[model samples]
Target: MRAISMQEFGGPEVLRIADVPIPQPRGAHHLLNVSRAGVNYADVHVRGNTYLAPVTLPYIPGNEVVGTTPDGQRFVGLTPGGGYAEQALVHRRVAWPVPDDISDDQAVALALQGQSAWHLLFTAAGLRAGERVVIPAAAGGVGSLAVQLAKRAGATVIALASTEQKRHVARDLGADAVVDSTADDLTDRIREAARGPVQVALEMTGGKVLQATLAALAPRGRLVVYGYASGEAATVVTHALMEKSLTVSGFWLPHLYGDRGALPTSMEELFQAVRDGDLKPIVGKIYPLGEASVAHSRLAARDHIGKLALDVTR
Candidate 1:
């Protein structure tokens, strides 16, 4: 088996494709022949040693993947690490069958991002019909799905993206309003689009975007912070919460699956949505597993849109 390993965290150059033994499944765990592995911002954070969770040196990096078990059961789920390889072992209970309508690439991309978007809108934010929601980075993997899920929940979506092209993509994804965050006065544009403060905010970009998102929330509104893509984390202003009577919560999808006992139900709902054509991940780029370094470089450069995948078997 070939896997991407990093002896030390620093840059993309630290990733190397090397031969390694395939891992065996234990207990109820199943060994998957890795077909596609989703590359997330968290992967880059892990590779750069910026994530709060510590990583051991010479470790394989990947979180969510889509493949099959020894018996040929197609599934998607999270791995502790070590998914950037030819094969991965994961708990069978955590993995869900991929829908026939979804390709291997789409399944891998949705395993994490799609689930996160669903959980954030339905569970964490408690979004309801006719409410207005703002989704930052609406062109990215999770953001794209968030836009669709918000619409399905009957919420009017205000999508914030970095470029006009991405804004157009968000519109096509079902966002009622699209704002270019790269342009000056994003807060103003959001206000104009929504006609007032938004009821729910799906925030992934931190720092200035987080602050701006907080400022854009309606009274008693909720803002779910999922990632820090700005390369800088943001601090919440207590005054803002006090003034607007707003709620701010952080969403980590793995915690719900690992701790809240919601994996099975969540996966079921997401797969059903995909099968019904209500949800679909926007897969932007696919790279061979050996080109893990190149993939990381593209992510770091912010050149690609939506989810990037590693074709492990290729």
Candidate 2:
């Protein structure tokens, strides 16, 4: 098997294509012949050894993939080992068989981002119907799904994207309103779009964006912090939250990976949504497996929208 192996934690340059023994599945795990590997911001953090979980040296970085079995069954899943390879080991509990109508790219998009978006809103934030929700980074993989899912939950979605094109994508996904995070009046814009202070804010990028979104939350509102894509930490004051009785919670997908059985329901719901024409997975770009470093660079650069995937067979 061919994989992009990391011998040390550093930057994209550290990922190198190397030949390795094919992974063997045990117990509930299934061997996946990977077609597409989803590259995420977590992979970038993994390369830098800054992820929430510790990664051993000389490991592969990808967390999710869409692939087939020797029996020709197509599946999408989070790989227990690594997905930046021609093949990977997917725990059967986390693996969902791909529908005949869903392409590998679409299935791969649903693996991590789909699961993350679902958990962020329903599990972490406890989103309620008729609430006003704000989604930061609304054009990226998770954000795209977050926009659609938030709307489906009967929430008025105020999607924040960095560019107009991304904002357009958000609107097409059913966002009630879209705000450009880079706009000078982002806070006011979001509040105006929501028609009031938002009831739920899905904060991803840290720094100014998080601070602004926090300020835009309604009284007794909930803010679910998922990632710090801005590479800067956002400081929160306890007094500020206490004044408004606001709640802030952090969500990391790895925390739920231990409960393997917890994933199928959400995966099924996500797939069903896609199948029902209620959700669309935006696949921005596909790179060859050997260009894994390039894929990482593009993701880190924030040059692409939606999910960027690596075609292992290419």
Candidate 3:
């Protein structure tokens, strides 16, 4: 099997191509002949050892795959890792059969990033209709989906993106308003866009961005912290949160994967949304499996939009 493996923790340079034996499924896992592998910020963190969970050396760094089993059942679902390979293993219970109308690459886009967007908005944030929500990195994979999903849920979405192009993308995805993410007046912009304090916020990048988003939230508003893509964790002031009556929570999809009911439910709704033409996935570049390093470089640079994927067949 051709796969990308990293032996050290550092930059994108650490990911290198290697010929390793195909992974075999055990227990509830099913082996898939990987067609495409979803690339995510989490993969970058794993490669650099900065993820919430630690990674061992000589690890394969992809957690989402879309492919077919030996039995010819096409599946698009979460893998425990090893997705940047010609063959990988996915838990049968967590994996779902691909819709006949969807492509492998498109299915790969929805598997992880799509689910992340779904859970981040509804499950973690407990989003409700008529609420005003701020989604940081609104042009990225999960953010883009969040924007569309939020709008579909009848929420007013204030999107923040770093560039004009990304801001335009967010607006096209049905955000009520879009702001320059790099603006020094981010908090002011968010509040103004929503016409006042926001009811909810999806925080991905930390550090200064976290402070700005927190400042934009209304009393009793909830904030979901999912990722620190900026490589800086937030230093929250407990007093400020207490005074504002704000709540902070964290969301990791794997935790819900254990909730058999949650996984199938989320996956079904996510797929149905796409099938009904109510949700559209944003897919960026698709790199060859051997060029996994290149994909990481693009993701780390934050110069790309939507989800990146590895075409294992290449």
Q: Please identify which of the two predictions, 2 or 3, would achieve the higher lDDT against the true structure.
A: 2
For residues 48-141, write the lDDT of model 1, one tens digit per residue: 8987578888899999988887788888988878889989987876787887777887788678888888889988999999999998888888
Model number with the top TM-score: 3
The lDDT of each candidate is: 0.85, 0.90, 0.89
TM-score of each: 0.96, 0.97, 0.98
Query: What TM-score would candidate 1 get against the native?
Result: 0.96
Quality of model 3 by C-alpha lDDT: 0.89
lDDT of 2 by residue, 1-314 (tens): 89999999898999999998888677888788999999999999999988888889889878999888999999898864589999898887788899999989889888999999999999999999999999988889999999988888888999998888988988888989999898777789989998889899999889988899999999999999999988899889999999999999999886788785668878888988898888899988899999999999999998689899999999
Backbone-clash count (model 1): 0
- In angstroms, the error of model 3 at 104 is 1.6
Candidate 3 structure, TM-score to reference: 0.98
RMSD in order of candidates = 1.4, 1.3, 1.0
What is candidate 3's lDDT per residue for 87-109, written digit by digit as tens?
88888888999989887866887
- Clash pairs (backbone) in predicted model 1: none
Ranking by lDDT: 2, 3, 1
